[model samples]
Target chain A: MRSWLRSEDSWAVLTGLLVLLLGLLSLAGVNALGWVPKANEWTTPLKAVSPASKAFALPGGVSVLLLYTSLLGFLCLGAWRMGHSVKRFAVGFTVLFAVGYGCWVLGHYAHLATTPNKMAEKGITWGLGLTSESGYLLALTAGLLVGNFFPKAGEWLRESARTEWYIKTAIVIIGGVYGFKAAEDVKLTQTVLVRGLAAIIEAYLIYWAVVYFLARKVFGFSREWAVPLASGISICGVSAAITTGAAVRARPVVPVMVSSLVVLFSVVELILLPFAAKLFLTDEPMVAAAWMGLAVKTDGAAFSSGAITAGLLTDDPAQQQAMGLTTSTVKVFIDLFIGVWAVVLAVVWAYGVDRKPGQGVPLKDIWGRFPKFVFGYVLAFAGLLALGLWLTDPVAKKAVKEGMEQADQLRRVFFVLTFFAIGMGANLRRLWAEGLGKLALVYAISLFGFVIWFGLLVSWLFFHGVKPPTVGGN
Target chain B: MPDDKRTAEELAKQQAEPLLPAEKWLIFGSISLGLALLGVLLWLTGAM
Candidate 1:
């Protein structure tokens, strides 16, 4: 119980809600989050940074400093409680934030990130047009260089490089954004949420069955190996693999091996799938969003893929936000099922597959396996949603949006950190040296030959013909 | 039937034993099917 209380998951929820609470102070007419830094597209360095809100008219560098200090303090508090070396973490996080945010500012250069619509005014004939979120890709690439080439730096930074916690915090902040959008158009937002739930359920059942069969019959893996592999590849990646591993009483090595592969492949999917979705599914934006949630494995990679795909597929900020919300909604629904599915697997393995005398299903493991950070996500979302619905005054509604805007900017900062952390944690040489030939082959075949296409089909079935509400239109 | 076919059938059934208790499969299948139906209904109503 003590260990669970101090776990990274619990800290992530607490940290995330603390940020949201500060932002929520806008309801009382104090924009506590307004000083958060935002990077804007610019031809020159001087024009690139600003306070997230016009109300806090601090100089750009000051805004960045405020952001850094607050994040360092908030994260260090968690590190201290979680039994990490707070001094080392603070130092490592400082360097990481500097380098990561530097790449983010570079990605905001006019020639690299300016969209087509703004190209004319910027006097550039063409730009990469990846949108401001290009910072995520830039941060990822820069971190990969540090990880693969600068082994000493990677080791030094390892104590603070927490990809999952960063992404979960970002997710909770995004839930607030979703709630604000919901207030704007309840019917549309609810539809996206409902479709996302249905799509994940339909896709998961088929995905698990097919992958399990393929691993068992085609790859000729044993049940112990196949069950966790299927769940890892078919469900929410590392968490699902670990939970299913415990459920089936597999050796720890089984889930650990599956987890490394999931991370590597999730990064690969993050890099590749967004472009493919943009190319093939651009017209059906919601389908593309759902596809990203289902096809990408890890939460960080999945949410990042959604943002990149949304950036590529549209110029409208409203549409891009909607795409991201749809993706998160689907992924969260999938996350909700990990505990339930763990129980199902436990029951089956205990009674049917490898039952031994005195071996009972570990039903209590379900609660242990539940993703704790999801509570923060749901709370932020529901709180903002209830406030949106209850507030009748237009003035109050505008303040709510203003507050959420600050939270959204902070979410982007966490996302950039997540991208860099994910890249740094991916050790290509280690994955290669581990003799993962059969398992890699199975993942390749199952993912490319079956899972991706099946996910696209399921997404299309549920989300076809649905479009997000255009700006100012419901 | 050929001897090989008979052997394969026996092997298949033996391998399938763990997945028995067809009731479990039935319940999961019904849930999935119901969700699919709900999706279609929602789509038809433009509520999903």
Candidate 2:
């Protein structure tokens, strides 16, 4: 078990389970005792107080900040003990503390500033929609400049950039949100689930085939470049690129390069997909929401785009709420496929592609290479789903919702950390030298020529005419 | 004399990078079809 905790996935799953357990317990105890925190309330604005840690506030009004900072410091210390330099850990922790909290505050304010309702109240009439794209864009840009122009600082920042762990943990927490949120309207969720499942299949089959062919035939890339590039273009870009890199046994640079492209293009899609979805698919709103999931690969970009698209296109508040829910359902459906997709690809690579003749691809290889944190995600999802099903009582149902509300808040904090970590690791100059110019061209052509249109068509075919209930209680 | 010769041979090998597998087409093609089927099953049962 001590050895097990060294792995990123194992730590993520254990932490996620701990979070889920604590949330359930704290909510249950509070309900039973009729006690509540003085300053405990859930809202998106910045107050230095968090829903999750508010119950345990200290004498100073700095409980959440202290807890959050300590959690990161411990993670840093863990990495240091695991065989990193003290200087690197020191530099990394400083940057992580500064950048993580900085991005959170900036994203919060950007969200408030760009919100359409707020802008409308000020008589501005036109503003960026509900999404928090501005802060992420700023973080990515600052990272790129630092990575290229000030390489020393970037190196320090990159010390704590455990992008995979951060993202994986958030994904595990997202599973709980699904179980809790999906219970509200079973019918709509089922539809989103089915359609999203079918759509991901089409996406994997059609999109991967076309982009891969283009990479090989058109761009003249070798299999390593083609496969990772295709994976980044076809499915959830960051994880897909990493998985393909490992499956193909490519160099470490290959995944990093591919991931850089994914991060850059995610920002592009963040700016473009929502406006396009609104322009075309307003009446078929759910389709637009699903298209956001299919087209944009990163979680922040996809959900932010969905929120913006939903806000811009729909005037009905209930419809907007439905759109938000449907958006998560579709995105999680696509995100969950990475685990299964990784296994299948590993088998194909080991057995069918790169193996020495007569050397069998052992099952153990696949299991070892497999992402174990995915089990935590699926288990959490299933547990919550079961919980939702069993909690037929009204009070029990309400408790589940409140508990998950805190979980989702923590998930967003993890996601914001993930964004900073991903950005810190990226260097545009390296990306360019590693064939970003060519890769960018291929990515653009693949995304615009096939990915976006195909996603739109399939989304429309499956999710068209599915309107959420307005002016009715679930 | 043998060590020098071995070093020269290793340097030559280091400079040459191998091309990707010839079986890539067959690999991705077959796997994509299989994944599609798996996806259909998942959708049919709403399992995932």
Candidate 3:
């Protein structure tokens, strides 16, 4: 318990919670702490001043971008101060922030390049539907390229490339965003929430177990590698891999390995799933939607796949709309699995698996093993939801929405930083090492062969007859 | 003496290692599935 609280994960969670709490409170006009980021004060929408100018047009000023980066950098500096000189840490953090910001800007440009309206202004068909997440991919790619080519620099810079810390904070912010979105449309959320609950159960009991067995029995992986790998493949990818690694007390390398595989595979699915859906599953589009929820691992990629799917097949607008909404809903709904599953894995590991051969673990050890960030995540999600529910006044709700949006900006920055750092942290050569070779093979067969089919089956099972809320539909 | 030392090291290593506690996780997995079901019920009834 002592180590658990003192652990960097705990500190990061506390940091994220306090940042979000203060920001939200400030929005509610309770900004007693003048230093805190006031609610709705984080960002402004893009200003469309000079109509023909080539600059960012979105809201939330660039100052917050700098503020969020510096604040997070110092928090990281505080987290790592024990390991490095203050001056060195500060300098390294500046470089890290500069690189991340550059990538974010480049990514923003890529988004603008793909926007339909922007492209139409140039007489180009903006077909890709790429969003700001393109920046995350660019960051990851750049980080990997740098890390692979310059091992010496990779080693040195990795001192500040704290990927896990950044991601956990983003996830907590997402909890708030999710809560607000869920409350924004209770009917839609409820529908997705109910059906999505069933989809997750089928995923864990069937998808997770099957993949786990494939890793262990077929590929001959040890238990530690296989468990986290199973969760990574079966559940929500990178986040699930990290959570499972912690629950099982596996070394950090295990989750890192599994996470790399997930990122690579998710991209592949992101590209292939949409085209595959349009070509084959257009007839039974909900099946494609469910398949998307089952197949696409991360939020960004799943959403991109939905966008692509919607853009491509235009035969039935009603069906396409349903497919798009269902795909996003099911995927977002699956994002909720991390908190609950982490709780389950924690109890199992502390009490059941990690006990001594002839010895038993104390009940309190569960506290140590349970991922502390999950509490921050769940509390933020539930609190935001309840707040949205209770504060029915339009002005109050609008204020909450603005604050949550600002928090979301913070979350995206962290996510972008995390992907870059994960790329930096990964040793590409080791990815193809002997053990991982088999791991890769297992991922290939399972993702392509089993996941797609089973996703379609279960999605059909639960959502076949349950069509989208379309009017005068046959 | 060396033999005894090796045995102690092995024991410590075993004690330190992750024990692949799949069964306990199985029980927990069931609990998670149940909670997911509860989520569905609550959402349907507008209690969530």
Candidate 4:
């Protein structure tokens, strides 16, 4: 039994199982506590406005569950023989965790009562409303930091077979949440067409043309590291950078630098963009939302910016909804393109880096490097949309809706977990080694470019006589 | 032992030189120009 368990394949299976189990148990615990209540009085009215009212419940449980498991996994990995430092882990986890908790606290208490029928019109509230999943996940991340510092307690929990089992279960269950079909259900119109096209173009140009030059030319980054660092800053932020780094076999330090810069810049954007909107474009909520959505690198920062913009424009419901929908939709559209962009970069890197007399990329290199799970994600979204369309029966539709909703909830949880893992993996020392000057330059250039492109698109689309309806007035 | 040595050699061989001093200034200039063009275009279009 000992020999069998000690085998490499056996260890892999064991670890996988541990991840899944932990995810499930944490999910169950979060749900049981009603820590994040499914039905809130505040969001009910907003639910009524939405075509899918039943799918209004916040997926906080999934978020918390993912957070806890991911943190646990990171701690476990850190505790292993790997050269993971406690101080580095603690620092990264603490900042991310605090941000998460702040979100949760804001969700639970902040009220959006300025508008009449405050419950139905799901405007941005300070404490908690529908999309507080991000907050709960953040809190879980904080808990991980606390747990990590207490090594004796962490060790006690780590020794247990049950704990291991739980973590593995959570990872597997997390996979079920990435429903491909839901992606198709997201309606695309003229607004989406323009935004989607802009996002894709901006992601590449900012990464290559702007951020790349800054990283290499200004900051004095080597080509090896500059590519991934710029890609991360310009594309979808940390995750995109990390994914691209892994695919291109970039130096570990590259991802660390990217993650640090991303986290720092994201926080800055969150604070600055809302103020910029209020000060500069107070009368133009749609333009403000569009600018925030396009300029901000991360979804969380964009959402935060949108929420602040909504708060500023509380007197106008139509404007508030438009702002909220536009920011969320644009961010989601950007998220959807992460896989495609990664693939394109992977192909580029193969030819550019791996093909020469001394270095030759394999034929199967791109396929091997590509993130296959994204295919599963796209497939699940497409499959569900097909089901939703083909099955005309109300009962069938209801079931599909429920399934998709659950999947979305699960997806949120996985994202939280992934972020937690990312935080765990992150270390400032690694980032310092990569140098800061280049990263700073890249981020500045990218932001500048994004602002201009996004602003142009908004002006072209809505500048002329497009009197967007004022809140509650139209 | 030979394989490990060969791998190390290959890794060392793959390392590219960091950006040159002139190259740095050129990149900086290009990025600045791009950003300026974008900003001007947006301003002209009444986006600001």
**DockQ, per-model, please?**
0.06, 0.11, 0.10, 0.10
Candidates in descending lDDT order: 1, 2, 3, 4
Better of 2 and 3 by lDDT: 2
What C-alpha lDDT, on a 0 to 100 scale, does residue A18 get in candidate 2? 63
Tell me the TM-score of each prediction against the true structure.
0.91, 0.76, 0.68, 0.53
Indicate the worst ten consecutive residues by lDDT in candidate 2 chain A: A33-42
lDDT of 3 at A433: 52
Say which candidate scores most in TM-score.
1
Pairs in steric clash, model 3: A27-A39, A43-A60, A44-A59, A44-A60, A45-A58, A45-A59, A46-A57, A46-A58, A46-A59
Winner by DockQ between candidate 4 and candidate 1: 4
Please identify which of the two predictions, 1 or 2, would achieve the higher TM-score against the true structure.
1
lDDT of candidate 2 over A1-474, digit per residue (tens): 676667777777766776676556634655221121112211333342333434443432354455456556667655754565656766676666566656545544533334565554444555544344344555555655666688787776776777667667776777676765566667877777766665567656768778877777767776767777888888777767776667666665665566677877776687688778778787888989888888887665676567667766765656765676676666666666765666666666677667767654344533554567767877887788778877777876776666666666566556666666655555555434432456678888999888888788777766787887564563
List runs of model 4 lying over 4 Å from the truth: A1-36, A39-106, A110-195, A243-249, A271-293, A298-355, A362-373, A394-438, A448-474, B1-48
> Could you tell me the interface RMSD of model 3?
10.8
Model 3 chain A lDDT-worst window of ten:
A35-44
lDDT of each residue in A152-185, candidate 3, tens digit only: 8777776677765676676667667667666655
Provide the TM-score, chain A, model 1.
Answer: 0.97
Q: Poorest 10 consecutive residues of model 1 chain A by lDDT?
A: A429-438
TM-scores for chain B, listed for all candidates: 0.49, 0.39, 0.41, 0.54
Tell me the spans in candidate 1 whose CA falls farther than 4 Å from its real position.
A1-4, B1-48
Per-residue error for A98 in candidate 4, Å, reads: 13
